[model samples]
Target chain A: MTVGRKLWAIIIIKIFIIFAILRLFFFPDFLNSKSDTDEGKGDYVREQLINRN
Target chain B: MIDQIDLSMVDWARAQFALTAIYHWLFVPLTLGLSFLVAIMETIYVKTGNPEWKKITKFWMILFGINFAIGVATGIILEFQFGTNWSNYSWFVGDIFGAPLAIEGIMAFFLESTFIAIMFFGWNKVSKGFHLTASWLTAIGASLSALWILVANAWMQSPTGMEFNPDTARNEMVDFWEILFSPMAFNKFLHTISNGYVIGSIFVIGISSWFLLKKRHILMAKRSILVAAIFGLITSIFLVGTGDGSAYTVAQSQPMKLAAMEGLYEGEAGAGLVAFGILNPDKKPGDGEDAFLVKVQIPSLLSILGYRNTEAYVPGVEDIVNGGYKPWFEKIPVEEKEMTYSVAQKIEKGKLAISALRDYKTATRAGDSILAKISQKKLQENFNYFGYGYLNNPESVIPNIPLTFYSFHIMVFLGFYFILLFIVMLFFVNRTTLEKKRWLLWISLWTIPLAYIASQAGWVVAEVGRQPWVIQDLLPTVAAVSMIDTNSIRITFWIFAGLFTALLIAEVMIMVRQIKIGPKEGGSK
Candidate 1:
């Protein structure tokens, strides 16, 4: 392959590694995982906010 | 509602975010400006029907691709961090902040991504005109992406067009147009993009200067320098104007930041601009010690810059924290003043606002609409100082003054230097004496890193200057972090630090290899 295609290949692989593997494993959304429903998430955030001194 | 919070977690989370942001920035400005510079080169190539121009365009495009790819890798992590490390910040201001980010993803990112493919791969397959259009569109799309993100950032710096909703426990967007067209947003977008343009020009000229020093691609180096120097000169001048606009906005909206940027302890009418200074390490807001150890200042410049009047009052850190100084009118030339609350008074108002919000929430839960309305009204009245409620002391409001002051001065100093460098470069190139000026060539080559330093320093001034506020006046950063364990953030920070450093090394290696290969071997056309 040409050098251009090689660079493109690296980019695609990097994205897949970062988003699909690393993000899913290491960086799950905190609020989303805190509760199953929107109301629960809202309650979680509200509790965190109000309880801060 | 929750257990005793770990203060260490908050500090670690901040460190993680700062790490990601600073690293992300290293690559982003290059992509912002280089895309446009490459497009400009391509336009010249097509118009002139010159193969040499095509070679130059293709060569630069390769480097742009390298920087753009790595930049995206770092950028995506920053967004994810909001959900991971700063979930509370995300949830609190999600309704308002998410709009710009979502639009950035849906519109600008998509536009740039689509055109970038054509820009890279459709060279021989597409007509020259179509390819050129794609190139231009890619550049435009990158800038549009910057626009939305910077607008969101500006809103954080100067929160507007949002209302705190007690029922939802979040700040919600009330006026989309107001958020989009805020004066802070406008200046931020212009300043940031001009900064990008300047970085791009510097990068181009810097690399071209290397070629001239080596006595290879002599013609190409001269042509590239000519274009880049002209572009750099114009954008550098524009960057100065935007910087001034930024200072004025900061003075009007974030006086604490302005005070910190100057390290001013005791404010006065017609405060001079600090041309250079060393901060007194022992100085505190109310302390009688000198704020600066040694200093040189341009008389009345700070007043003129901040308030557009020679004699307009500029507040010091002490004045802002202890409060007796009147707030100048937002309109330039400062015709009138209004009474301003001290930090202590604002904290009281903030507590009232917070209490009212709680009451409003409770009333809503109890289905008492009348009580809820009254509580909401009270909350609204004091909501302007809501973030201050979380602070235990007025001293917590002071950001790291030394960092902000130094970063601002460094950025300003480098900005003027860039204009001078460009003028000298243009003159030498025109006279065909640039290659002979070995010292100048070395200076030009070294400027690539200085451009990066200047760009990063600008962000340091902006982000570090407005410390303790994730969303200006509304939210404290300590309250913004997710309630996750500190160890997790610490681990991730190390992981990211190691990973990003590796990526940066690989990028530099690849870029160096490409630069060595030279334009003849770039082989696009």
Candidate 2:
């Protein structure tokens, strides 16, 4: 492959590893994981804010 | 509703985020600035119809590609970190913060990715004018991305156009345009991008100097030096101007950060700017110990830079902590009579705000609209000092003095050095004896790393100097973290450390190999 093609391949691989694999396994979105609805998320945040303080 | 916070967990999460951010920053400035340099070189080639210029452009473009590919999406982890490590901070200001980031994704990312494809592969496939346009668009895309991100960050420093919604428990954008056109945003974007420009110029000239040192591509080296030195000279000067603007903004919005940067403990009119100083390790707030053990200063310079008036009062750490003096400028939405407050008073007000929020929530749940309105009004009155309520000790408001002070001085000193270096380079590049100046060539090559150091130092000053606060007065760093296991964050921190180190090693090796290959002979179309 040309150098540009090889670099592009690396980039694509990297994006997949970062966004697809690592994100799924390691870095779950906290609010989304805890609650699917906006109201639920707001309740969670309020509870955390008031109770934690 | 955990009563006790795992402070260790918060600290570890902070470390992880800092580690990722530091790593991500290593590549971003280069991408931000080098794209434009490459575009400019391509423009010259198109204008002159010179194959030699085309070869130079291609050579630099390949280096730019290597950097862009390796650095791209490294910041993806940083964004994810917001969800994983700082979930509360994400949800709290996400309404205000997420807008710019979303815009950045939709506008800048697509624009950049599209044009970059054409710029890289369309050399002979597309018309020359079209190819040049793609190159310029790619550069603009990178800068536009920076603009949105910087606007978001500037909001953190001097939050504007945002209102606290007790119902959602988040700061929501009330005026998007105000947030976009904030004074801090303007200064930060210009200063940060100019720093990138200076770094890009330094990289070009430094690498070109290496070629000259090895007695290879002498003509190309000279030509690159001529263009880069002039570019570097202009941007470095602009960097100083923007730095001044930043200092002034910090003085107005974050007096404590300014005081920490100067290592000042006593308020004064006509405060001298510390040119160089060593902090007294024994110094503590209100202890009357000398703030600086030894120092040199430019008289009244700090006052002038900060307030644009030589006699304007510049408060120090003690004054900020004790807080009796009236500020020259205040941005917080508070009653005019309540403008001055000690840290202790602010903490009291912040606690009131928190209590009012709790009451508002409870009242809403109990269907008490009248009580809810009363609580909401109280919360707004005290909300400016809301983050202060979380602190147990008033002095906790002070950031790390020594780190902030030293970083500021080092960055300032380097700014002057860069200007001088560019001037010398511009002169020497025109002279016949340029190639013979082996010492100067070595200095030029060494400057590449120094430029990176200066760039990093600027961030340290900005970030560390505002310590303990995630968003100026609204959220404390300790309060902003996710409730996660400390050991998990610790493990991830090391994982990132190793991962980023490996990436850095790979990038350096690839860059050096490409440099060894050098530009193509007789140039490519």
Candidate 3:
């Protein structure tokens, strides 16, 4: 590939790493997790965001 | 459903989405109109072989490139957010909303993305006719993508041709044509694209006027002004017509939103439009205090605009809460058809829907077919106002009226102001006459930021007016959010804010530098 194409590829890869890959590893899918019951999960968010204040 | 949504999570997710949308908008309007403008210029150049038209087209093309890049960057995050921040909403309407987005990718995005490459890279490689076709196709592609997305959004506001699939626990499309050609969606697409057209016209006029002011590129700037003025004027007229259609739709599908937008607290037989008014801050629903502080109203205009006739009843906040609109739905046969349903009635129905769902869940697990059947029947019957079940208080249905009321007025005022601006520009602008009128040129230059403000304000009116609803009466905004920790969203929100801000600064610096360079040197950069 040409140098221009190579540079564009690297730029795109860096963006993908920052947005997609890093997010998947660092930000767990709290919503989809099976550890908590539906009510327990709902209550957790409600308490943390709204009723606490 | 008994519990109110996690307010903090919803608020944070909304904030993040708003940030992304606002940033994305900054680039989209320019891309929408400027692409077509550039194409028109190129068309002129090819037909006449005018070097001047080629230079003008190249100059704007550079700016469009700068704007389109940032728009795409911000746009990807917004799409990702549908899966992350609003997972519940995604699941609920995925069967319906996903179609348009998919079609947008297959039809609009491919058309735009393929041709845009040809437009930029195939300048000398392809024949002039082929290149011109690519340019027009790119613009059409961008517009078609917007059409599908707006259709999806409009479905949320006025959901039509869709049915609740109780077995699947989501809405399913019964008719694709109905979804695509809903009157509300059609009007929305027309109105929104016209808005983009106006923005593009202003951008061309503003930048060209700036060049004129500097006594540089006077001839090219004049031609640009002439084109944008004629185009802008025509679109501005259409913008007003579609605005009327939007108001009419709000009256029919989301009356509560219209009531909030007008700051009307009590139903009236002949309601007048608020020509201009300050909302009385102390006044709220159930309070007897007058809603507006200082006001000017056009008698019966709202009634005419809302309904075709002046005598048609317009429900207000009090009417909504006290059961005015319930009577309209009573003609349809239902198990719970009463003379009228107060706030209490709606809440009971909403609670019934929620309870029925819970029973169905329990029955399914226990393998109790009879119980599941009974509960599913109840759930389907009262599912119209399912979002209402989450409200702790009946009064929670009222949107933030002060914000909606003012936003709607500000948008309207600016819209009419733009028409006036367009008329003045069109009348005064000539080959050389516009060059001399420094004051008019100054107005054209300053009108740029106001055009942006008006566009943003129009969205505010639309979104804020809907209030509690994420999908009209079907889903509340709070319940639609993913059950994520507020802190997680907050941290990312700030990160994106900083990142997008930096990109914006870079974009502006590059744009300003290119504009300063003029056509000859700027095109290469």
Candidate 4:
């Protein structure tokens, strides 16, 4: 292959790798969970404990 | 007494953290080390005018693709679990944790993603310079992601740049820059990223060595090994340095963790660093009973690491466990106890009230006082705080000691080994004798497993060492979990496990197939 074509290939490969990484790492809300809100579901339990005391 | 509820919360949170951390790491190291390898490959192609270099880059890129996909898939669940499993923790510390995550999204994610698309699909369309820029951007993005995640994690360990807000019942950021640049954050970030680089390099080296052994793609394999070795040497050296810095930070910020890591049991000046010991926590150290069975001590190491002096006092596990904070539960005053109890009760009562009100409204609309009364009685029953006692004293809270202790040691041992290995590799490569040695090739290959083991160990130590604390000294892990049934946790766990397993298997299969085909064919494709 010619020098330019080899250069083009190298450039293309690098771009592909970069794009793949970006898509993988750029995820928003990556570590946040939906079930976390369930703790808020049982406020009555706490209120009852306090009232009893 | 720290009851079962507290301990179970810790166990649950820890299990979740461990599962996510182990899976996340399986992806991250590859990202770090592979990016640098690709960069080097491109550089070689530019410098040496070798099309084979281009071929090598293409081959690795394919493996990177598979790993990247699995990494992304496994990684997304961890974020969601923050809300799902640890909702109270999210409410309490999300103000602090969310900042870095936001920054990670804005600063690293966008830059990485934008350029990555151009890089991946724009091969024939985009300019050479633009594509190279994209490659560097992806590396920057990966490193940046590590930075933000470490910043958040370090803050959890040391809790800097944030103050408690009584109104929100949470810790909020006072200064974003302070949290970002905190000593622990910086040290941990450097240590983690360097480890990632080591993992990436070792992965390349190991696979390349396998290719060389098979006499497949001889020139391509040799060049890949040489590149991997160089990257590995540099990264491994830095990994050790950053690890020392991390140890120092841990000593200062969490003396208890340091004590646990070393398996020390007494307050001692000029303490020896234990190389290996069966830690009998049951017996007191230096009671002349010899609690450390077959103790091997490197004199003055612990003292130097902890206090910057060989004679400074380093508190041991016994000191930490016995001194003031013995039963962590007893430390909470009545007011804080009342507040927590009240909040939990309010949440429970509110849920019941809402459900009862709904049932009553439905019964009244249907003109049925009997049904309404039944719903009212059920609501009243649910409103009772009889279950609160159970919440305070949970069942099924046991420490998995063997796993915890071994994981901690594996991480520490790997840290030291990588330091020595990297230093030796650097010396050999600098002396221009790197290529002539077949053993270095083998060592580099073996280092792949070490990289993975080290990552796993670090995570195990982080999650397991913080047993009983989801928010470190504040919230227990069990209390942080969703009130979902055990069957729910089991089902979700299995489903996640199954899906992740499938993805992982597919990833390995793709990588193996690519390696088998060799880079020469890969490049032409």
Question: lDDT per prediction?
Answer: 0.87, 0.87, 0.79, 0.62
- Estimated TM-score for each candidate: 0.97, 0.97, 0.90, 0.75
Q: Give me the candidate number with maximum DockQ.
A: 2
Q: What tens-digit string does per-residue lDDT give for candidate 1 at B1-525?
A: 223667788888888888988888888889988999899999999999989899889889989998887678677888888999898888888677789988999999999999999998898889999999999999999999999989999999999998777766778899999999998999999999999999999999999999998999998889999888998999999999999999999998898899889998788999999999999998877769888899999999999899888888998888888887786654633346556788899889988887887788789889999999999899899999988888888888899999999999999999999999999999889886778999999999999999989988899888888888998878888778888888889888898898789778878988898888889744643
Q: Per-residue lDDT tens digits of candidate 2, residues B1-525?
A: 333888888888878888888888889888877888888888999999988898888888888888988899998898899998888888899578899999999999999989988988888799989999999999999999899989999999999998989999888999999999988999999999999889988999999999999999888888888888888899999999999999999998999999999999998999999999999998999998888889999999999989888877799998988888867643432235244689999989988998999999999999999999999999999999988888888898899999899989989998899899889999999998999999999998998898888888889889888988999987888778888778878877887888788778878987887887789854322
User: What lDDT score is found at residue B208 in candidate 3?
Assistant: 92
What docking class should model 4 receive?
incorrect
Candidate 3 per-residue lDDT, tens place, A2-53, comes to: 3224334544754774478535753454445623554544434423222211
Model 4 sits at a Cα RMSD from the real structure of 10.5
What lDDT would candidate 1 get against the real structure?
A: 0.87
Candidate 3, B1-525: lDDT as tens digits: 326456777888888988978877887888898888889889998999988888888888877876776566467677677767876677678468989988988999999989988987888899999999999999999899899889998999998888875554567899999999998999999999889989999989999999999999988898888888888889988999999999888887888889998999998877899999988889968879998889998888888888866766688888888883532222354345444466667877877887787777678769999999998899889888777776667787788898888888888898888888778777777645788889988888999998899888888888888878889877777777776678878988887787778667866777777788788732444
Which regions of candidate 3 deviate over 4 angstroms?
Answer: A1-14, A21-32, A35-53, B1-5, B325-340
Per-residue lDDT over B17-116 for candidate 4, one digit per residue giving the tens place of the 0 to 100 score? 5665676678778887787678678767656766777678778776665566456535656776665555556665746898788888888878866765
Model 1 DockQ class? medium
